[model samples]
Target: MLDEIVASRDAAGAALTAEVDAVIEAANAMSDRFRAGGRLLAFGRGEAAADAAHVAVEFTHPVIVGKRALPALCLGGEPALLGMWGRPQDIAVGICPATGDLAAARSLGLLTVALTANEEFPEADHVLCARSADPLVAREIHITVYHLLWELVHVFQEAE
Candidate 1:
């Protein structure tokens, strides 16, 4: 089982590397949107939501020595709001409404970035698109995505 897990990880890593250019490009686009006075919003369910929140906090408060604060928000942070929304999918849409919501309207200038393990959600301007092979693999991909996002944000910030 351990060997199989290691082999799976190795395969995932190889596949991920093959798609690095596309990932970097997507990250760059996201960074551009964010630099233009747009907020990077992350949303997911359960553990994925926790991962989203973790990434959001990292951007809001960079641990890196010289990195500056970048605007990032997680839609699942408020338990009351989540409870009202009922599901992660609903919250994703609610947070970045197509129209109607005053807060969403106010945040129109901000770029809405969505991170989800669920590919069904249509609100995501940029989707991380997690591989559904194994739980551990999914987690690792999320971590990679966050790290890439951070690097991209820094690049965008520096170019300003």
Candidate 2:
């Protein structure tokens, strides 16, 4: 069990390393949007929904000192109404897998993102693939990814 856990961590590190630069770029873009008064809208299904809420909370109230509290909302249901509240400058992060809202986000001119294990996810301005089929491993990787996002976006915000 210990060896399996170690191997899973290794796999997550390798996958995330390949995507780090893109992740940082996306974070910068998100920071830019936030600076322009754009909020973040995240959503997912079942387990991912919890992460969506978590992401929103993290951005809205960062633990990191001096990190601004960016506006964020997690849509749990009734995705059809997203456009009503969503704005062109907002950012949307679709967690775990696509629930069919990325397209709507794009149509609304919002920045779009998809975080999933599949190579084919909702088309988005950014796609951060967790690259793990195992749920436990994916969760671990996701925690790291979002933590980095929260921290790094602060860096970009400070730079701006």
Candidate 3:
């Protein structure tokens, strides 16, 4: 059982590794958006909604001292709320989004990012897929990816 778990994670990690360049590129774009006064608005349904809240807190209240507390909000999977608050410079991150949310965000000119496994969100400007079939494994990979994004965004911001 443990071996299966380890192998699954290894495979997922390898898949993400192959996309490291894309991740870095996305992070750089995120940094640029932040520099332009953009905020991150994350939304998801059910369990993913909790993850979205965590993502918001991570950005708005960093665990590391001296890390910039960027503006981030959890939309509780409410695309209507996004319509109310989204701006052209804002970022819309959909963690396993329902149909049309990412589309709506893109229609409003927000940079769309999708964190998902298996499900395809074509509207997202950046799609960070977990490469795992298991829901738990996918969730773990999403957490790692978001953390990397948070760290890399700061790295790029500081470089400026």
Among the numbered candidates, top lDDT falls to: 3
lDDT of 2 at 83: 77
Residue-pair clashes, model 1: 0
Report every candidate's CA lDDT: 0.56, 0.81, 0.88
The residue ranges of model 2 lying beyond 4 angstroms of the native Cα positions read none
Q: Against the true structure, candidate 2 has what lDDT?
A: 0.81
Score every model by TM-score: 0.70, 0.91, 0.95
Whichever of 2 and 3 has more lDDT, that candidate is: 3
lDDT comparison, 1 vs 2, better candidate: 2
lDDT of 1 by residue, 9-91 (tens): 78767766775765676667666655555555555555666776776788889888899887766776443343333322221
Backbone clash count, each prediction separately? 0, 0, 0
Mark the 10 consecutive residues where model 3 has the least summed lDDT.
115-124
RMSD of each: 6.5, 1.7, 1.3
Model 3 agreement with the true structure over 1-160: per-residue lDDT tens digits: 9999999999999999998887888888888889999999999877999989998999999999889999999998686688889999999988877767788779989988888885466788998999899889899988988999999999998899
Best by TM-score: 3
